[model samples]
Target: MPVYTHGGDIRTAQAAYGGEVLDFSANLNPLGMPDPVRQAAAQADCAPYPDPLCRDLRRAIAAHDGVGAEQVVCGNGAADLIFRLVFALKPKKALVTAPTFSEYEEALTCVGCEVTRYTLDQDRNFDLDEGFVDTIGPDVDLVFLCTPNNPTGRLIDQDLLESVVKRCGAVGAVLVVDECFLPLATGGPGLAPWLASHPNLVLLRAFTKSYAMAGLRLGYCLTANQDLRERLGKFAQPWSVSTPAQAAGVAALTCCPHWAAEGRGFVEGVRPGLAAGLTAAGCTVIPGQANYLLFRLPGVADLKERLLTRGVLIRSCANYHGLGPDWYRVCVKGEAENRRLLAALREVL
Candidate 1:
């Protein structure tokens, strides 16, 4: 399978720039990983192999989401589950949002599936509208959606989302919604509650971003279909999740119910100032409800390099399907770090 380019590669930046790089490329929690999760991970025993089924972690996640344990399946990471779904279902055709996460297309192509794109309008700030539902048809076998979508950081409207889900079900197409960023969003109910009503709907989530556990490689999927869950498990490798990752995930969900809310509130509080700062620096900031913001400015093609010279790193959205070199994304970090980024942008711009 072809690899997808992602953010948060501080090692590469350090090698190239030879300095301390403040990365706004990856949209992770800036508050840092929780202490309880760290303690749990440190205390976990790695001498024994991890539970292949992730029994304890699944139960913890199920209890936290108020869903049945049978409805949940854990994976090495969200990416692992994404590939597993594509391999298991082997859909002939797939529909996905352009400029969203790249893995959906990569996995689909790996299975020799034909892919179609529904490009979101830049004029609309990349928001999904009612017209998206029209893109779903009987010919499509699968659909992928990312809420508070990557690169653009725009959430799907609840009404529009429901309409799309219903249309996909009617057409007999499976709908997979990526809710990895949902925990960092300020408001709106997650899609977990809809699992009972929409068996075709698979909700994907991870502790990588919300709990700052990216290195742990932990993620999960929620579905009401037992057969589908079984298929996913069959396709996955044995003991995919490490013992420490499972321990950390269980601890995170059990001990840090308020961590997500706290991170959301912190992002919501600081996002406005970040937007204002970027705008004053002469960039057109795309307003987002997530923990990150997408913006465009003149000479952005070279802006990333300029910021790198100053020990700051930002994501260039040019690689995302529908975005050009003019587009960029930055995480809404803490006050001091946000100010540092703004200062670097002001000088570079």
Candidate 2:
């Protein structure tokens, strides 16, 4: 069986199942891409070279994020930014949480940085706590955190986040908070308010999940430290963000203010029932506030494979750092998709 790596695995599913696949792996905007974003992408005159600096898009992102344009750095995606930051900082030692996104470890390892995992207790629902703050010391040079964390989707508490940020600042460790899923995350007042005070903080965000433009590959990071921003420029190649993606990003922020909010509200409305349905289907669903739900089915070792046979592709969280083969994460999609997924589970179970 092909390994279920990331979401939007329709082609892989088709090759294996030879049938239509309802993808619940990628946790994107349930409403799909906004029309304005599509239009902006379509209208992008790609004939000329892209603005290597991505001036206009950065400005728009700045306005939306309430940061100076100089503080913003655009990239193909958050993963791109991750690698770039890793290369730029070249930190000797770093700290990351377990059961979170894998890119941080991948990026850090690529640069030969020693990574220490501060494991989140899965029994406590994989939510970060105060003790994680202690992991940030003078010895640790970089830290990665995710709000509405991947695979598990539980949010970081604001106070806990502050402690982490403050602790990082005290030790001069650069804290990279990946808030890519924050817009869809309900009740998440993101840590943007701390950027002004803490120069060591980097808020990594992306338009892929929130704007439903995964194909466009639009992502950026916010930081107050001019040296860090300038260092990113030194490491990143020119035109790292393509023209159409740039246009789409600008449109996502400036042209469509409520687009993210719409997706957030829609996910908020649908996620509870989906969690309930998963629980009813004999899975221990981790109640999350983001656009996806993470659950565990104890007896179904090959649940992802079985679902693929039914033309349903849900993320197998087996590969996530602190998770196991029994765990899975599925996006909270629209009604028809959700219904088909539940029906497939009913049969496969």
Candidate 3:
């Protein structure tokens, strides 16, 4: 497997590098999985068939996000929902930002959709500016955008985001704003309220990163467009969310109300020191609000492989569009882990 395709491939990395690896590749919560969530998931009854529509999970999500239960559609994960959305709509043309999530392009390509990429300039810290809003026109049938974008960890300006939503609405294009990382960012959630006004807008949310439930595979999308929301489930199997996952989602929202804020706080507290360490170790770090940092190690060769030899795994940005080979991403973990990473870097660099 191409390592850059996604992170948390400890099995593959271990086989190749021959030792236990500390994974900084996947951007999960520093708090790790909550004990309450674990208990709820472990005790879930697996004998009966799982709910095809994920009604109970939707109700909990709707209450947590302050939207109608019918407006919320649960899926196996954010990625599974991405494929379902693409299959349901099957848009002929799509617009996506470069250096964003890869699955958007992958899903769009599966439908033979001609994709137009608006590359974000890394010199500007990969900020999405007004020019991106201008790119949305009637010719584009679908658009995929990420706030607190993956790999880069930059959140799009709200005004700029709404402008894109308005432009997409005016052009009759569907806009999917993936806010998978927003719960852990500095700012609280946004854009779900916009669903009442714009039918073309879809907000993707997942319990994977914030709650560290990647193994649970619970994710959902919120939209006011009931037809499109219902159609999302049609393209996929009825039981997209498993029994354990539904219980976990409910427990995550109901029992763990303050979990996201705690995760955000942990990320906020450690990110600065982590960035400083990376800079002190001969890397230029980008400022971001997400639970991760993007940095470039100057004149470093095979940095990822070298780090692997030291039992550390980081997400290399080489496969990310609009990024050169030198760029890399690391999750904002606990103080000790962050220090360990820096110590390892001090040796490698």
Candidate 4:
């Protein structure tokens, strides 16, 4: 399989450019990791093997989400769960959104599944409207929807999402919703609440972005279907989540309940300034609700390299399907870092 191209590789850029690089490529929490979660991970006992079932971690996640522990299944990361779902279900026909996360396609292709894409229009800011419901027919055995979607950062409309659930249910199609970025997006209510009625819905979440636990690799899937959950667990390797990751996941939820709210506040406060700056620099910025912005500028395909020379790193959207070379995505970072990024863009753009 070809390796996937993703953001947050400061080490590689540093090696190539021979300098410190400010990474706006990864959409992590700008508030940084909570001290409690950090301390918990550091203090975690690595001597013994982690719990294979992730009992305590699942309980914590269930409590946090107001769902039963039976509905939750932990994984190495959200990507792991994505792959597990695809492998377990072995859906011959699957539907996904174009210019979204590549992992969906990667996992589906590995299983030799027939993948269909519902391409979102750039003119519509990549929003999923009512028309998307029509695409989820009886032929599609599985559907992948990423809300506050990657790269573009546009969210799926609530009514439209409901319609999708209804359509998928009518067709007996399983719907997997990627909500890894929902916690960071203001006014973004995740679809976990809909799990009770929609047994076909599988909600994917992670501590990687919202809790700044990317290195720890803690993620989970929530579903009301007990059979599907069991199938996912059977396909997954034993003890996929590490000791530190489990400890950190629990600490993040119990110790820092307000972390998600704080992150949203920080992103909302700084995103406007960052978007304005990027727009002022001659980039057509996509108004995104998540803690990131997607924009396109003249020569954007080469702009990532030019900015790298100035010790800065940003995600080039050229690899994403339905997006061209001119598109780029950047995290809404702290004020100082945001200022530095704008300054770098001013010089390079």
Candidate 5:
């Protein structure tokens, strides 16, 4: 079997270390799934096959995004939608960032697309720069941009993103903006305001993050272009998202608005406290906008092993391209869990 590495792989950790491991590897909301959404899923129809078209769920998403229902496409998760986009578009050449989400490259490579990387400068705290797009040529057919990027938790500047998309559009390159981490950040509707004007733009979002539905596997994509939306629908398998997942998607989209606000506040409240704890242990915590923070600790390789021995599972960034073995990423969990992580790190370090 072909091997793939991705986030939320806590099962491996649990099996190796025991079942009660405290996971900081997955950068989820940490509040757990919303109770209302859970109730909705429990009450939803389970016998019949889901709507192949996902009409109701798409309509709910359209209502939430204030866009037409036809523009939305639901999937098993953002991962399913991402692969569909790659297969449907079939770009010859694509640009993505190193030390970012591994799935972007995996999807691109599976379709035989040539993947190029614009490395994030570690010394600059992995901040996105406008110049990264300067090297893109007319031959490049797609640009995968991750906002509030995974592991690093850094967001690209709005203006710089606009510049990239505008230039990419001029060259007929599809620009996919992965906003999976956006809900974790405190803000207004980001980049969605530009979707109406940027036809070449595609936005991928998920309930897996802020809504705390990681295992529920619910996500959707937004695009103003009816053609691309249709193409994604065509390429996607029918009823890829389950009935329970569809209901959860709607419930999470509608009922979780209030819960999202509280979750954001909860994440913001814990981020600094965790950062301080990491800093106190002599780790360099990179400032970030989302719920996760990146840090560099001396002997991180050894420290990770020690943490595992202590039943704490955190993401060691050694495998992420352009990052070194000394780097690690930790998600901001609730106060008690965060404290447990801090205590483990302090002891291990």
Candidate 6:
């Protein structure tokens, strides 16, 4: 059988460097999984199968966001939902920001969709410009915008996004916004507010990031367009979300305030500490509201191997569509962990 690998495969990294390694490559919540959510999984019944449609979890999320349950679609994870959305829509041509999440392109390609890239200028700190609306028009069927976008950790202007959505809607394009990292931003809401106005808009969210439940594989999509949700539901398999995942997701939604607040606080508190450390070590840390920070080492590629040898795993951005060798991204971790990573990186650099 042929084998394929995705970036941030820890087992592959572990094989290369034997030992428990701190994972900064993946932009996950560094505060770790919330205790209440973990506890909920333990009490959930595993004997019978989970709700095929994730009824309870959907209700919880809908109530939490003040949306109708019918407007919500739960999936195994955000990635699964993204894939289903792409498959259901079956866009012939899609537009995505370069250096964004890899899964978007992979999923689009699986549906025979051709994708176009809008590269973010490194000098501009990879911020999305109003030009995005210009690139997405009648020719495009899907438009993906990642706020506080991956790797770059830059956000698109909210008004600009709204305008882009309007343009996409006018041209019958589906506007998909990935707010997976939105919780990390200081002033932004999770794009839930705009769902009513833009019926063509689809907001992708997950308990995996802010709620620290990545392993639980809990994710959902919110849209005012009932038919899109129905199409996604039809394409999704029965019980795509497991029993424990449903329980954990409900717990996450109910207990979201505590966990989200704590994770945000941890990232806020550690941002300066990590930035200072990186700056001291002669790297330029880009400013952002996300839990992860992007830094350009004076010469990061030169030190990648040495950092790996030190049992420290970091995301080297050479593989990212628009990013170059000097770029790297790391999730904001706990205090001690960040300190340890900074120490290792200092030595490596």
* lDDT top scorer: 4
Off by over 4 Å in 4: 1-4
State the lDDT at 204 in candidate 4: 97
The residue-by-residue lDDT of candidate 2 on 266-325, one tens digit each, is: 888888888888999999998898999999999677999998988899888888888889
List model 3 lDDT by residue over 1-349, tens digit each. 3434688888989998888889999999999989989999999999999988788888999998899998998888999999999999999999999888899999999999999999998788999989988888779999999998987889988888879999999999999999999999988467988899999999999999989999999889999998997788678786778999999989999999889889999888889999998988889898988999999987674788889988999988888788878988999999999999999998986
TM-score of each: 0.98, 0.97, 0.97, 0.98, 0.96, 0.95
Q: List the residue pairs that clash in candidate 5.
A: none
Every candidate's lDDT: 0.91, 0.90, 0.90, 0.92, 0.84, 0.84
Q: Per-residue lDDT of 216-301 in model 4, one digit per residue for the tens?
A: 99999999999999999899887799999999999999999889889999999999999999989999999999999999996657
The predictions' CA RMSDs to the true structure, in order, are 1.4, 1.5, 1.2, 1.1, 1.5, 1.8
Any idea what lDDT model 5 has?
0.84
- Ten contiguous residues with the weakest lDDT in model 2: 1-10
Pairs in clash, predicted candidate 6: none
- As a whole number from 0 to 100, the lDDT of residue 197 in candidate 3 is 94
How high a TM-score does candidate 6 get?
Answer: 0.95
Report the alpha-carbon TM-score of model 2 versus the true structure: 0.97
lDDT per residue (tens digit) for residues 161-271 in model 5: 878988988888899999988877766356766778999999999888877888878888888988998889888887798888888888887877666667778898888
Local error of candidate 2 at residue 1 (angstroms)? 14
For candidate 3, the lDDT comes to 0.90
* Residue pairs of candidate 3 with colliding backbone atoms: none
Give me the overall lDDT of model 2.
0.90
For residue 32, model 1's alpha carbon misses the true position, in angstroms, by 1.1
After TM-score superposition, the amount by which residue 338's alpha carbon in candidate 5 deviates from its true location, in angstroms, is 1.0
What is the C-alpha lDDT profile of model 6 across 1-349, one tens digit per residue?
5443333567766888987777887777777777888999889999998999788888998988778888898898999999999989999999999889888998999988999999987778888888878998798999888888887777888788878888988999999899888876655766788788889999998888887777788888899998898899888988899999999988887875567766777788888889888889888888877888888886558555677788888887777788778878888888898998999987776
